[model samples]
Target: MNEVYFPYFDPDFDKLPERINGPTCRVCIDNESMDDCTVVKVDSVNKQGLLLEVVQVLTDLNLIISKSYISSDAVWFMDVFHVKDEHGNKLTDQKVINYIKQAIGTTRETHNSAKAKTYANMVFSPEPNNNNEHTVIEMSGTDRPGLFSELSAALADLHCNVVEAHAWSHNDRLACIAYISDQSTHTPIEDPNRLASIEDHLTTVLRATITPTPTTNQPNQQEAKTADFLGGEGAVTNVERRLHQLMHSVRDFEGPPSRTASLPTTPSDSESDEEAGMKTTVKIESCDEKGYSIVNINCKDRPRLMFDTVCTLTDMQYVIFHASINSDGGYAFQEYFIRHLDGCAMSTECEKERVIKCLEAAIERRVCEGVRLELCADNRVGLLSDITRVLRENGLTVVRADVETQGEKAINAFYVRDMSGNKVDMEFIESMKKEMGPIALQVKNDTIRPSSPERSRFSLSHMLKASGSLITLLLSSNPCKYS
Candidate 1:
């Protein structure tokens, strides 16, 4: 009569109203349990990507997830997250808590009634239209040192200004989203001819030398093409989420390295273990009794790491059944129990390996290896172009970039290295600060870790072809559950 389950969720979850007929969400916040962080518990009817949606709500608000637990199986689901503000203190702001409820704790009768879309069905149609004040440009292709600079220059020449932009590169694949407007009128370009022209120019830049021979009709062999979806800025699709989709569309996890090889050379086992030491360790195994594939990961802690991992799993069509997240001693330890959307555990060795490859690629995509620079200046029509041109001319390569606008000011962050993949010269960086004005351009993370900068290099193709497997050990034991 006293028996108890070790990893407990909500025992009364089955009795919640509308548990069987519709999606119901109940989110509770407890601030007294932990002094350093607030504990958030969410119980709801399960759906595909439900975990990702919850995580996205918290991450978008810039809250830090210190630890958490997740369980979603059969008809019900429950998740607990220990969270803190950016200052590492438990959340105390009432306004932020209310917003989190509005965002993640709403019932979804509509979602319960509608069928979920498959990966193929989710691709944005390439049709061009004038639907918003700015034009949305989506692209994916092989990344090069100055590809962004080239694209910015081309757009500038076409009388378009990039007002907001995000670019991500992984495994030599580049995924970019830019909201552009007319340079002169500062509005969406409506002329059919101009839109056509812009698409053509971007396709050329993306395809340059990577286009396949004229004989292939296969979708997998198709070169990168511009997909124009004119829309308001971040109104419908989450821009960052779409970036993940774009990279997966191009099959970045399996493709060969591009000519320029955005990632540095993979180190040989004999070269040094330092580079491998920094790798995000991943292991996947199946629990047949529970019908779930458990994934365990250990890695150096970083911002948004959980979001990136969960995003990959969701995009890969895996549903999380249970999870535990913790961070200590500057390292992250996470375990996820998941299964395919159809409710089957992964069965094949190949399947497990693919999951590992995809997870590793996902984790490394956001890890930049060079000096991070932040630029703040008054917004201008061709501001992005000017900044990118400066980087290109200075022999620097932007591995990652985040561009946004606030009020009348332009705020941009760039992760840059030399044309060759190595630590940047401080003297050159100082010169750049002087050129761009010291107060306007500041070095945020100037001290790049030199011990194993190559660990930041991630090209799935290179990782496989070089050593034939990932650097992480594959453990067979399940990670211990959080108390």
Candidate 2:
């Protein structure tokens, strides 16, 4: 018996496997064909944003798309992705396989259109009448020092326990989504008055800018006071995807680079982009003959290059009629033939410039800023609030953060910088490690970026905090880089 037809993964897609399917999208998982990875093929009728959904599902599952062949020509869209687990291993885990099957495979539900059958890639229908476990808070505001700190403090003062949060800042704009619950009841704060209070409190904090230390709330026009709340069932939401959507909604990329966004010395995406003396370059040109606008991007190769590009295009109401994506010599080359939803190509310099800026913003938003500090401690009430307080004390500003709980463990990560948007000192990093515990922290030197750095597990001497124990930390730098 030939070992299952699964293929080996390529660093980036080289060639798509040959496959044929009917009009409805049918996903086939082949394990015996390639040597190193799982070959996932989806054949179906083409739609404008289907690829974005499919990519989201795969990436959200934490699977890496090492290679792919995507085509959406005529009425058919076909894609073949060579995928691997985070460890670059073929996915042999049954649980992971089942998730893939349930998410975007032939086992998925399919419905018929008038002309052809198509599958509902993912509907995300909200649950009906379930008691929400947490209340969700979403905001897109100005990027400033101690912003996350002040916000976390406000939540703590209000007796709100933050269960999970994901935030990102680019070009002086901040977009965040957090899931919080009442500290006592540990349930969603569904009261209308309480929600309004949170809105007002957060709005006040957003307007306050810091000079050395925040002594008072000062009027800041650059800040955005956009805050809204809903049921916490959104806790299961996609963090990274939602961050991208929220950032776009704020039009964060439309303005000239602010001091927060223009700091080149900080250990951020911009620094890495300029590393090796190369930068991500985006160009847009009109293809008058084809009635399309052609977008070309050349950047250092990393995972999710396609996702970032496609996500931006989809959100901007641009339709990708055809695209060619590939990696060569440690670089990613992407070309998209796109048009507006109105079926017209970009006709003005303004439109082209806007697309270019937005696409560039999309690429940089995911890049790590300052340093990344990962915490693996026991989950408890006010864990996040305490952590942010310590960072603020050390004059650290968080540009990006991802907080989560896995069972009893609080798996948290913060990408932080100094108040003036500079890299953190090594002295402070050591101080944090010492404060956390003996061998409580692990720092990896990141030379080239991965999709995102994985949390370093302190397995040998797991000095994790126990329940109800308060933890404090001061963080600086993206300490974990792919070597």
Which candidate's TM-score is highest?
1
Per-candidate Cα RMSD to the true structure, in Å, reads 13.8, 12.1
> Per-residue lDDT for 1-483 in model 1, tens only?
898768777977865655566547888889998878899899887877778878877776567787989888687889999998756888788877876676676433322111111110121222222336677888777777788888888888888878877788767778888878888888877787788889889878887767565675545322333444412232344567778878877777774455455545565343346546766889998798888899999987766778889989987888888899999866899999988978799999999999898888777777655666655566766667776776777667776777765567676766677786656765554443343322333344334333322322223223222433222111111111110
lDDT of 1 at 27: 85
lDDT for each of the candidates? 0.68, 0.66
List runs of model 1 lying over 4 Å from the truth.
1-23, 107-131, 211-235, 255-276, 436-483
User: What alpha-carbon RMSD in Å does predicted model 2 have with respect to the real structure?
Assistant: 12.1
Candidate 1, residue 365: the lDDT equals 74
